[model samples]
Target: MKHAPDFLSQEHDPRDPNPWLAMYLDRSTPIDDEVKRAWLADSSSRSRQVILPFVRPFARTLIVLFQVLKFVTPRKLAFSRTLHRLLAWGMQNFIRPEANWLILRHFHVGSQVLAFIGANSPAPVETSPLTPQRIGDVRDDLFLVHDLNLYNFVIRLNRALHAAGRELEHVAEPDFSMIAQPGLRLEDMPDGRFNFLDLQSSIELFTPIYQLLLTDDDFWRATNSLQLDETIGLYAATILDARSHLVLLNNRHPLVPMSTLRAGFRLTLHGLSTEMLHKVLFDRRAAQEAAQAALFAAGG
Candidate 1:
């Protein structure tokens, strides 16, 4: 295969900026949009660097659990060891109340997780015995990757807020409330009644206009005072406190990775550097990139 010996220099074509080269090699780029995209996407490696250091102990426990679950001869003995290991893992991870506190303090955000609440945190409803086993259609289970990022931001915020001692009733409101300025909608839920709203699927559902909303100078000023971590925690705490008010379209879309939630309120804040989040919280680099690509493709 004749791969370009210096693929990094291929952007001489002028039309395509060849952002992926900058992305992988961490080289500098003249184009601002390309630079930001490369940075945000590159965080997978960064996340590994930060998170892998903390995961070895948990990993070892899992290895022990798997070994015990696999080869022990007596059923009762196996069950007992397995249960002990599993419970220990759970307590270390998410079962401890203090873990919940750290999650709120460090990693929550506004638009992602809070949208799932109903009038109250909806209790698990029993499916009907008459319901067909295959009642729901199974598909690839992929959603627009963009929505996942935003959704995660909100879910973490809610978890953090709950850890901070707020009730879901006291805080959460829809993104539309912040973006569109609407009054609260109250309703009932499995646990209790409180304020709520049924939200549509995907933050991108509002993408065409979300930029305009985000651009409001007043909004930026309002949110600017809070540090990124503090903001995320408050966002999550508010949502959990107002869990009854959230109406989430997709249930499978998780707020936090179950592993993180169970690991005791711990959060791995992913995607882009904190400096970048601050700079671009008021900007729309991704939307701008897509628009530029489309414009170039159309010969505009």
Candidate 2:
């Protein structure tokens, strides 16, 4: 398969300023290859060069802290849930609004891609739908810290895109008021209590974070290179699927620890990226055609 043109070198469409969207939407190249190429381009970009040095030390420190936290924290459901709630509260108060929008927008785009695949595919594709409550419930400090670093890159990219008279289309402006109610207690909210209204409000609050992460190169490169020593997509997909399944089971049984739920939420984002690649790369008709051609040659 032909590789996608280098994102940095290629002239971007004004209507689609984000090259990752173009990569996600492209059907000609395998999605994994497109992602890999995007990662390479992003890593070498001037933006990454400037930002990584400043972010690396903080990231390394956080990694060590995360390891220590895991070792000390009890693996109990109630205890973990309380910790996650505290973390969520911290994130809600501290993280920038722009960062929140970027994060939420990534899921919005993922939902759009899933819709597109469903419309085109002959078989129904199973998806763990992303909603506002699910997004706002995020509790992973590690994910948030990495996202903070990514936000620096996104704001710069958005500024550059704006200067070039190009803008990312299809992203809706997020409203913060919906979920930032007075006396709001994220920890107190019970499981299965969030309704459609809660979902709407959460979406308003979290969309910006999704947008920021989606625009950053390090986010893409990190996800692609996760478990790099193993079979590329398979291990990541399996781990994501397992985490998601645990979340599903928790929904039914309410037994699993909050660490599992937190891992599940982070994995959902990774899973969406994987799903986008799989949907784009696995063309059933093309596979069928290739199989038929091979069969005909073998018969002769």
Candidate 3:
């Protein structure tokens, strides 16, 4: 408790695992690894700061959802992997519409509202879903998403190209075919392939970062860029646009937190400032301090 009285001081340790730094620290010494682990722990503790500001407008509604869904969203049920697999499988299989454009628009483009749920990194870069007989020409080949970041970048770039009366497909082939070189697999991520939650469970804990993904350009850029190979992760969004499809699916509203229910969900992404995130991360008694603060506020 007394280790870090000052948030700014070097002595203060934040326990948040910075995604950027966490990507490294793998080959470090055991002692150094412990140091990084502590830092990551400290970083996460103050995650509230990064998340709260964005969700503040909807905090009240979130509380209501928790109260209402307490029965419907029992933690055990929501976090159930078996249940999530069933749902995702059902979505991918049971849904009808075999056409390329229709499928692209609805599932690939639309329903991404569920991206926060977990957009499985697209199909592996090496595997092209379209066979020669299926599409015939190289241009007609089908590319599946293995990396959401590069996929998103393609989506954004397509918007720019289309706006200028150009298109990614007609532009080039072998040069710009893939979005970016295949980098670390999210499944094989550096820090034990930490891509947040593996999947959306029926009762999963809420994370604000996913919600922010809808708005944070910086977040998008950081994630989507190419790896060393530069061509593997890249893809061109010729048929459908991602954000627009999201808007259309939402009836033209994207991440607006329109209803009280939506707003309520937003509140679940609690975050902490850099300083507070680190402070609580290192302090062994962070939870105790929070409890004390709550009790004091409640007239204890």
lDDT of candidate 3 over 139-159, digit per residue (tens) = 221221323443554455446
**Which RMSD does model 3 reach against the true structure?**
24.6
lDDT of the structure predicted as candidate 2: 0.36
Instruction: Report how far off residue 266 is in candidate 1 (Å).
Output: 14
Q: For candidate 1, write residues 1-300 as lDDT tens digits.
A: 111223443555567555445465553322224323323332233333354445545543543444344344432231223333432333233221222121121122222222322222322111111111110100111112123434344455456556765544432222222111112111111111211111111111112122222222321222221223433333333534422222211111232222211221111222222222322322333444567799899996
Q: Which ten residues in a row have the lowest lDDT in candidate 1?
A: 195-204
* Full-model lDDT for every candidate: 0.28, 0.36, 0.27
Sequence-dependent TM-score of model 2 = 0.30
Better by lDDT, candidate 3 or 1: 1
The local distance difference test score of model 1 is 0.28
How well does model 3 score by local distance difference test? 0.27
Candidate 2 lDDT over residue span 159-240, tens digit each:
6556767533221221111111122223333223222122222322333233222222332333332222122232222322
The TM-score that candidate 1 achieves is: 0.20
Top candidate by TM-score: 2
lDDT for residue 101 in candidate 3, whole number 0-100? 16
By lDDT rank, best first, the candidates go: 2, 1, 3
TM-score ranking of the models: 2, 3, 1
